[model samples]
Target: MAKYVLTGTYCPDVLEKRAPYREAHLGRLAGLKAAGKVITIGPTRDLTRVFGVYETDSEAEARELIESDPYWQHQIWTSYELFEWIQAF
Candidate 1:
């Protein structure tokens, strides 16, 4: 499986407003983990940037999976970019 990075910018206001939804978002991430689609997930040190690693055949698939996340559906995301990544290490 190829690895892809799903990067997105969060809506700070929405994030502050929906602090309670973090757990549900984690639950959805866990579902992806259980299904072997995601490798890991976390945010940048500044906390404004979010990114996740997906193990799949293509970037489009990764984008589709991320879009289905509750966080995305609930307007927690303000901007997003999908990339097909290559890891040399």
Candidate 2:
């Protein structure tokens, strides 16, 4: 597996917009976490962006995971970029 970094931009008024879907979103992530697919994930201090680390066999798998997220499906997350990461430590 390779490490991937995912940085996502939130839609405007994200705090209010994400409410209904938050529970489902977090629940899904929790499942991925338990499965060892997600390393760590959270929003930035300003909540303008969501950042996460994932371990997957390929970038396609990572992209699929992100695209399947409730946040993405609902537009709570407007856009995202995923990159393969080489952890130095």
Candidate 3:
């Protein structure tokens, strides 16, 4: 499997709107982690950005996870980017 990094920038004032959907968003991540698909996931300390490193067979699978996120569906995220990562170390 290859690794991919998914990054997201939260929308302005999203903190207020995220409460209701936070659990579901986290639940999705938890499922991935449990399945060993997620390597690491978390928000930046300032909460402006979030990132997750995932291991999947293809880039499409990684993109699917990001698109399926509740944050993406509800527009809690204002911007997103995905990149294939080669962890040399």
All models: lDDT? Answer: 0.82, 0.96, 0.89
For candidate 3, give the lDDT of residue 72. Answer: 88
lDDT-superior candidate, 1 or 2? 2
lDDT against true structure, model 2 = 0.96
Runs of candidate 3 exceeding 4 Å displacement:
none
Query: What TM-score against the true fold does each predicted structure earn?
Result: 0.83, 0.97, 0.92
Instruction: Give the lowest summed-lDDT range of ten residues in model 3.
Output: 6-15
Tens digits of per-residue lDDT, candidate 1, 14-81, equal 55855877889888889889998999987777778788889987777888888888778887866788
TM-score preference between candidates 1 and 3, better one: 3
> Worst 10-residue stretch by lDDT in candidate 1?
11-20
Please state the error at residue 66 of candidate 1 in Å: 0.9
- Candidate 2 per-residue lDDT, tens place, 5-37, comes to 999899999999999999999999999999999
Give per-residue CA lDDT, model 3, range 2-55, as digits (tens): 999989898777789899999999999899999988999888888899888999
Give all candidate RMSDs, comma-separated.
1.7, 0.6, 1.0
Better of 2 and 3 by TM-score: 2
Q: Judge candidate 3 against the unseen true structure and give its global Cα lDDT, from 0 to 1.
A: 0.89
List the candidate 2 regions with Cα displacement exceeding 4 Å: none
